[model samples]
Target: MMSKENYEYAKTLYEKWGIDVEEVLGKLRNIPISIHCWQGDDIGGFEVNRQELSGGIDVTGNYPGKATTPEELRSDLEKALSLIPGQHRVNLHAIYAETDGEVVDRDEIEPKHFANWVNWAKEQGLGLDFNPTLFSHEKAEDGLTLSHPNKDIRDFWIRHTIASRKIAEYMGKELGSPTLTNVWIPDGYKDIPSDRLTPRKRLKESLDEVFSVEIDEKYNVDAVESKLFGIGSEAYVVGSHEFYMGYALKNNKLCLLDSGHYHPTEVISNKISSMLLYSDQLALHVSRPVRWDSDHVVILDDELREIGLEIVRNDAIDKVRIGLDFFDASINRVAAWTIGTRNMIKALLYAMLTPNEYLKQLQEEGNFTERLALMEELKTYPFGAIWDHYCDEMGVPVRENWLDEVKEYEETVLSKRK
Candidate 1:
């Protein structure tokens, strides 16, 4: 909640930061933006009316292309990339499709085709981000049987991690950029007590495979996973603490943290500090808080605005790769993408000028009571609102109407329970 005084003070700070609100708005008038468009159901659904913002879509799901032929995937990539303005970058997630509920092996795909895809991306001058999951698949059954005493399954897991690293090497060689790989395990506890110790051991072993595999010189992989707290059989009990991704960081692997995945009570600044202590690059997933649900809403919601700003002011900003991770069902994909991107940009701009040093100084100098007062004052700071206004002025559409839609959605859910 921004107060009048806080808002005015934020305005004064913005002027000090040399941010010409009017000039930035003018530059953004025609800048391109990027989005993720892997779900086929959402492709070509909504047309972009404004041309000022442009970027390439991230392909995540199966598309019409050669599973083994990079040229075929490249062709599909070109088609999707063509839809956006040329200035944007395209991040391709998994390229191989599942067959009869099994992921096709990357080896099945010709190496020449993979090279061709990279060459084509180079020709088009588009940036590339590759997800390691491109080489593997996880079935619901796999999640259930992860702790099973089957040597064959364990071998498969090892193979999956190694193959993913190989693909990263290939992409890094072709794209001339560090290969990006995010590890999100679908494995977790279901109903009944499982051998927690065993799963942790296996996960560590699989990660060990990642560390041993030799990748290209410039390619650096970010090992990312999440924590889920909710009901039902799929509810994950062994969250981030159990896997101990910090061990990877201790051993020099990049750690990417998702904001929504933390325990509800975890402190945001503390989490950011811990991540920075171990890794060089930070990846964050932005979302609004909803009861027991990881709703990927835009960032302006009160809870997200406060915590998100604190994160930016901290030292994490320099190393952060701020990416939008939103989930949508078959409907309203375009609206989801538009709103998600818009909110991310707005939050980032606000973070760029947050009084992080001021907050830190106050905390260092004062007792607990003094620190609390400073925090309370920081929360009401009008920096976010001013940034929002700047984004609006720059023609980056802020969906005030959509905020009402979210409220309506929340109300409907509450009413249904009643």
Candidate 2:
């Protein structure tokens, strides 16, 4: 059947459940998923004095055509964005700063360093997000930053984070969208710490100083990300969930929850509602965790769907800032971004299409059987047809047809990188 025909048929089914298909598509188009730039280069930024990946961050496989320069990374990102539907923001790290081959340390990074990125973003009509590069540096080789025993080390990271927020402020002021500047540091111990309180105390003080600089919230919003455990910090992570949860709640900061940054059994989907109750707004770093925080490409799994459901049902779309965080060098890097981003958007669409109010009524009225049955049946609904129409309307390839373009690009553009 033609796309419009199939869409018309699917629209009827969804409308029966009180879902406005047209409205849903409109809302989905406006929900921008911040696509991370690290995926193109395997977290390897274009630093003049680049360091090896550290702080529990690792990218497997030796994929050819990894973006080696700022221009190449942006070009690869452009290609990926072309294949993906919807206008999205690009999430960047301080390390991705282009300083014209100058050795600009993290602490010294300025908004001018990202002039190219800001200009490109303006041309592409995309928003921008930022993160401070706290790991993979000599000061953080011990896996301690912001909470380092050495005051100088902690001060260095603090300066870097402040600089990052300033850069984000500049992007937001120029782009007319608030830029989320997230801070995730690798600061913990390899073995059992004699005392954890001191490190956390230091971190809290550092954060206070950083936020004291006072960038307007209209331009830049800050978030602090926590981790359960890292390669070197297996025994104890100072910025554990409990620590950051309290800090964020008290300090009025967004506690960024990375899907992969939790224990094996703990799922971030369950935490979204609880976090929203306390924080006016929150952020997410959506990624797939196979066994550990491996940073695999996101798949449309039950958790992803549940996350979408929570966000939609609670009407926290504006309250929650969503960003993708995964890098898989095993597959085509562009394909990785496309797959993960498309899945994230698909998850949101799935949630929007759901009869959430009806489900809530069912649960409230003790209609578990009907609710379960309806949920299961909805899974087999003509969602794929609706998705296809969305792509058709949005002028992007429908279904897996995007893979063909990736293959052609790989052969024509990626293969020639070396």
What would the TM-scores of all predictions be?
0.66, 0.99
List candidate 2 segments past 4 Å from native.
none
Q: Which ten residues in a row have the lowest lDDT in candidate 2?
A: 1-10
lDDT of 2: 0.94
Candidate 2 pairs with clashing backbones: none
Per-residue CA lDDT of candidate 1, range 1-418, in tens?
Answer: 3245644666675667455545544443333333443322322211111111111122233322211233333443444333222144444444432233343453333234345446665898754554543112332244422223565665665555566666666776666666666665545555645566766666666567556767655764555555554333244544354355655566666565555566676534456656676667666555544443344445555555554565556645446555545544433333454466665555545555545566567678866686677556655655556655553444433335434543453344312321
lDDT of each: 0.48, 0.94
Worst 10 residues of 1 by lDDT: 46-55
Best by lDDT: 2
Estimate, for each residue in 151-214, the C-alpha lDDT of model 2 and write its tens digit.
9999999999999999999999999999999999888898999998999999999999999999
What does each candidate score in C-alpha RMSD?
10.0, 0.9
lDDT for 348 in candidate 2 is 96
Count of backbone collisions in candidate 2? 0
Off by over 4 Å in 1: 1-13, 16-35, 39-91, 95-103, 106-126, 134-140, 144-148, 229-239, 267-270, 293-295, 367-418
